[model samples]
Target: MTIFACMPVFCAIPTTYLSGSAAAGGTAVINSLALPGGFVSPAIMGWAKTTTGSFTSGLYMMAALLVAGGLAVLLGMPARTLQETR
Candidate 1:
């Protein structure tokens, strides 16, 4: 519920800032990558639950991945250089 609600808002952030081809390409790439995760994540969660006999470990792992993804976006995504801004 929360994830579904937040995803559109989060996706909107990039689209609001980017323009033209960059905006189109960026959203396209984001959607393309995210589409597969929908399938893959459930498989992972199911496997984790089967192996551990509970969802706790899988939830924790998902939380850890979320943290890692946030860190990657914060630290790894390059800021626009002055040359590009002009």
Candidate 2:
């Protein structure tokens, strides 16, 4: 519940940057990629909490992952608008 609180923000990213069928594809790709993380995160968090006696370790791990993903998008994504690409 807490993890998914920002879902609306997540949903908006592809739509903002993409257009037409590309937007649909982008959304599909993003959600598909997130599927595994959705499954794994709870288990990992649970384990971390059990080990550390708190969720802080799991929260830090997730934060690190988010930061790494953001950096990846910044560096690897092409520097062009949808119109330019078209």
* Among all candidates shown, the one with the greatest lDDT: 2
TM-score of each: 0.75, 0.65
Clashes of each: 0, 0
Candidate 2, residue 33: how far the Cα is off, in Å: 1.1
User: What are the candidates' C-alpha RMSDs?
Assistant: 4.3, 4.6
Best by TM-score: 1
| Candidate 1: residue pairs that collide | none
**lDDT of every predicted structure (CA atoms):** 0.78, 0.82
Evaluate residue 5 in candidate 1 and report its C-alpha lDDT on the 0 to 100 scale: 72
The local distance difference test score of model 1 is 0.78
Regions of model 1 farther than 4 Å from truth: 1-6, 78-86
Candidate 1, run of 10 with poorest lDDT: 76-85
List, residue by residue over 1-86, the lDDT tens digit for candidate 2: 74467668667878887899999999999889989997889998999999999999999988888778767765765668534757
Task: Give candidate 2's whole-model lDDT.
Answer: 0.82
